[model samples]
Target: MPQLEPFYFVHLLVWGFINLLIIIYLNTKYILPRILYIYLSRILISKL
Candidate 1:
């Protein structure tokens, strides 16, 4: 198929890597911390 072209493969790989990096960065920078904070707060409240 036309999608099997080498240039298209490289383009797809580059964009995929960039998108993965952004997702990981955002998860660590924002999502993970918020989740951890909520979990810890629940534990603390339950212990009280």
Candidate 2:
């Protein structure tokens, strides 16, 4: 069984959401693009 604390609940939840958004943003804008580029380049080089 766990005890629930009340104060700062909204703050914690909001921070979690913000962190999730940052991770999603970074993966979509940065990581995914780089991965796609690298994979495409490798395939192109192999073809050439």
Candidate 3:
């Protein structure tokens, strides 16, 4: 009943979307760079 209400549903969707964007941004900004750096270092070390 409450979940089916339009206002609540819209708010839930908006918050969920915002949270998703934040998570993606954090991963790309911080987590992905570190991972890529480590991966590339390993490859370069192997080549050398």
Candidate 4:
């Protein structure tokens, strides 16, 4: 098999890191709050 280029590995690593950061940011910013709201609402409804 042929060897891969060094730049390809670097590019892939950079993109992977960027994608991971975006996912974490989105989860905390949007998904987490939505989930928390749903959970809190359920609790509130149960108490009523």
Local distance difference test scores for all models:
0.97, 0.90, 0.97, 0.95
What TM-score does prediction 1 earn?
0.88
Tens digits of per-residue lDDT for model 3, 1-48: 766699887999999999999999999999999999999999999999
Which whole-number lDDT from 0 to 100 does residue 5 have in model 1? Answer: 96
Going through the candidates in the order shown, the clash numbers are 0, 0, 0, 0
Worst 10 residues of 3 by lDDT: 1-10
Measured on C-alpha atoms, candidate 4 has an lDDT of 0.95
Write the residue-wise lDDT of candidate 4 on 12-45 in tens digits: 9999999999999999999999999999999999
Model 2 pairs whose backbones collide:
none
Q: What lDDT, from 0 to 1, does candidate 1 have?
A: 0.97
TM-score per candidate: 0.88, 0.73, 0.90, 0.84
Error of 3 at 34 (Å): 0.3
Candidates in descending TM-score order:
3, 1, 4, 2
Cα lDDT of model 1 by residue, 1-48, tens digit: 776798888999999999999999999999999999999999999999
Worst 10 residues of 1 by lDDT: 1-10
Model 2, 1-48: lDDT tens digits are 234554468779989999999999999999999999999999999999
Identify the candidate with maximal TM-score: 3
* Candidate 4 ranges beyond 4 A from true positions: 1-4
Better of 1 and 4 by TM-score: 1
lDDT for model 3 comes to 0.97
* Candidate 3: segments with Cα more than 4 A from true spot: 1-4
